[model samples]
Target chain A: MSVLTQIKQAPAANPIERLLLATEADMAKVNALILSRADSHVEMVPELARYLIESGGKRLRPMLTVAAAQLFANGTGTAVNFAAAVEFMHNATLLHDDVVDESDMRRGKPAARMVWGNKASILVGDFLLGQAFMMMVETGNIGALGVLSSASAVMAEGEVFQLAKTGDLTTTAADYAEVIRAKTAVLFQAACEVGAMSGGADDAGRKALAQYGLELGNAFQLVDDVLDYGGQSGTLGKNVGDDLREGKMTLPVILALAEASSEDRETITAALGDAEATADQVAAVVAIMERHNTLARTMEQAQAHARSAKAALEALPGSEMRSLLSEVVEFSVVRAY
Target chain B: MSVLTQIKQAPAANPIERLLLATEADMAKVNALILSRADSHVEMVPELARYLIESGGKRLRPMLTVAAAQLFANGTGTAVNFAAAVEFMHNATLLHDDVVDESDMRRGKPAARMVWGNKASILVGDFLLGQAFMMMVETGNIGALGVLSSASAVMAEGEVFQLAKTGDLTTTAADYAEVIRAKTAVLFQAACEVGAMSGGADDAGRKALAQYGLELGNAFQLVDDVLDYGGQSGTLGKNVGDDLREGKMTLPVILALAEASSEDRETITAALGDAEATADQVAAVVAIMERHNTLARTMEQAQAHARSAKAALEALPGSEMRSLLSEVVEFSVVRAY
Candidate 1:
């Protein structure tokens, strides 16, 4: 099944049906806009740019943008533009982030940086960022532009914060949350909020959507952290222990190390410090997480965020879109891939 | 004398006057604003955040930003914000550029990456970028945001273009122009255009200012390139032949290499390829430039650009500011430091 198809089928069994339904209700439209928006920039090299745009990533962020707009604009069509804008923002960040991380592989494919070289990757990422703001300007939405630029600023700040915290085991959950919000969730939140602002949702509706995205983003990242530890490498489309190899201090590892005996903590810390940590050593670190149930404990926190995200949706008047949003919350908890 | 004091005292004696007046008229207010925009979020270490901002360096880009605004605005005060915005953009690039270059020095001080580590530098750069956009957004001027974002995209593109062309002697003046325009001139253009837009200049006026800035920026970079080779080391405040050591394919070297014998070209290219070109080899390369009159040839091109920049300014109504700008063109061509 296609990614969207799998999402559609799983909604009935999901606890957070509203989340998925809201996202699903907008997915077809959001995906269509994303696929077509490239037509807007014929001046750029399509051959080079298409690989990234057509890459079969889920359109969650864009959907949130559109969904937010829909909520605020009294169900207007501005959501389509919001969706495209958010995706551009996400893709821009992804392209640059790959370079910063020196990451070679992403979503089971060679990353843009690896395929195109850092020069191409960095420039293209920049092109997309400019294009994003251009779209926002075209929308003639001052509030939307404010939210996006602010969110982007937060996102970069958070990424830098994470960069600062790298390989440091003293990192706390609060610290992790601040970085995660900036790095991942702020865009997601902005995506939804911009969507709402476009839809002319009253201030209150905009706030609700913003809260929902923030919580959902937190849940999404927590699950991402869990998958880094225990998910099947093939299924996750990430190398086993890629996070450990990268020396990224994610919540599972941070929490696991914090709770470990001194000897085990020393081992984890030493592995983090060494640039050349072996796969066996990474596996050993994973074993420590399992022993501490850090992944499971983190999973529970993810569940709490999912619940908060779902509850935020309760403020929205019921619609097919609202139901889909609820499903997104459950999908956040149980998705294996 | 302190840099600021020296800048203030030399108001019309060529370089000092243009630099100091520009700093006073454009950067003073903007620098104050730029200094105040840091995030005070409990999680962010403000001390670390302020490292680059507090580090004393000439606010040249910000001055350019303000000058552009002043010319466009023509007695309006809106240029101050644009000035700050442009400087923010310049500093953001510097933060990233430092990391990419892996250099450990700036203005005879530890580079942001050197003092704070690459992660901090990178993150702070991201923060500055965010702050730049935020400042633009506050203008409530979509056009301003568009100009700033477009300039940003161009800057990154130029960086990549330069990166791709490095050490490739086959690169032409046209290719070099494209790289320099992207890397440097566009921001100068944007700085001017954004000022015009804020100052309510007609499209013609805005276009004129942008063209002037672009030409001036080209001249500015050419002079910088020349200074790297031609200026006294201490006065230039940069290591002599620093660009040569860095393998930067600046205009003088490119021009010189173009005229060199096959053996000379090979020797220069090989020296460039080595990560550590000796000081004696650098001096030998300089000797070749003196022999071939490449420095004079390069200066002629810079002078031509300075002339074109002056011609562009003729479109603007003559005023004290206009005369100051005219003086800057002459200053750019003649300044030894």
Candidate 2:
């Protein structure tokens, strides 16, 4: 075969792709459970739910869950339930978030709210959360349940904290760290920790995996914040600089605001959270961030978290799973696409 | 002392009042647990949560939990947690519902969403739900947790169903029954069932309390529907016919529409979802309902459920607590104020 044909026939080329390939059998189960649980007699529940679920993002969170479980134990049954529950929690957050942010786009399509309305989005989010908790309860894993339930509460608090901080130029780097940890990293931590629990990992292994997931989550969110300013529209699943228009206090903005000249700062603040902001207005702010090296600095911060995440996996013995997980973190920080 | 003074000093005079007085000590603990659990690091979470929690409706749901538990066991300790969790679930629903309904008032005051804006209300509701699950997880009662988590999901489905049926003139009495059972009765049933579980009741007792709660809840909602037309403005915590204006398919509306002539039906339909419907317009609908005996018939339906609720208590052994519970049911349907 020609080289192009050979490449096409190859198994998988990258960390996330390889992870998906490795977890295919297990993810099929998780996906089935997710779809079955999303079903309801109320037709709209399944209709709107499937619209979002089938839109099909990377399913990264569930993948981490399945991966962590496999890393420790060989295909434990509870992992399927936990993985499904994690995905549900993640999607539930996304549904509520679109309403809160009043965003028009999610996963590069009109948001479920746009189709169904904000009321459905909120109620459906509630429905998914109920499903998530029911899944956890069904597994009869109280330990894992506790970790996830606590994480869920923290995530809500994080969102509230982030919402409160929105459009406030006074938001600091420390506050930004808190926001990222609570809103994003906590769930990742819970996902891995629960997977470890289901896999019957020992205390040290569970702690290490939890740390790895937490750090990876931090890196993932940092990259996302940077992407909101730097990535393509379809790539970000939203317009460029959505964070600015939403008044999100992302690392790039915080860093730029701290470093820019008074005149340049004026430019940034004017566009920050201005929903009517022109493309030129956002481009101007991006230029300010680039001049201050804030975007790249934010990437560096992501890299640091990725390093810590990779370091966390060292607690486990060397294995293909460990290496793949490590590479996932590394790719998260480095990839622009 | 004057006779009136003695009457006031003796004790609570009504069945509901007696429930309040009897459950006072336990309700205090439930309230304390509720206040403490509602506390959070995010300022707005606690502030909004407190605004709702402290707005202090009768605290009826938690009272049912505490009462059920007390009837079966003196004090198992888990009941307090369950009671607080129940209250949280309730407040979370109210916050979300107000946002869904675009309600300006709740519990005779400005709705939390009106005070804090829809975003804060939604986030805080989520935060409270998380805390509720955390409380459940902490109790380690998987059975009660299952009951509640499932009820939470059902409640969401019921709300969605109600929202879908809003202003839908084709709504049937059966559909209304399903909506009430899912949205209102299920939580009440859960509260009592979990309370019974925490109190270490036998299956039969647990079931009896659950039935009683469900029936009582049905009666309670029916009464609420009537009160929207019959009760004073401040008493309803919303204006008269707010339900009509919102196009809620309450029993009276459904019953009247089924019997009304096309001309009268047109009048009701026009005012059904009209937020701008004036007092005179609402009164005209009420007059139509009275002409058809629909409001009184709704009260009869409520009375039937109340009888069923009282009958449920017969399965339990006779006791002061059991009689008190029965009286609460009877009072529910009979009360006009």
Using lDDT as the measure, the top candidate is 2
Clash totals for all candidate models: 34, 0
Error of 2 at B236 (Å): 2.4
lDDT of 2 by residue, A240-277 (tens): 87889999999899999998999999999999888889
Model 1, residue B42: C-alpha shift (Å): 7.2
Cα-based lDDT at residue A158, candidate 1: 80
lDDT of 1 by residue, A247-271 (tens): 7888888898888999888778777
Chain A accuracy as TM-score for every candidate: 0.88, 0.96
TM-score of 1: 0.88
Interface quality of candidate 1 as DockQ: 0.39
TM-score of only chain B in every candidate structure: 0.89, 0.95
DockQ of every predicted complex: 0.39, 0.80
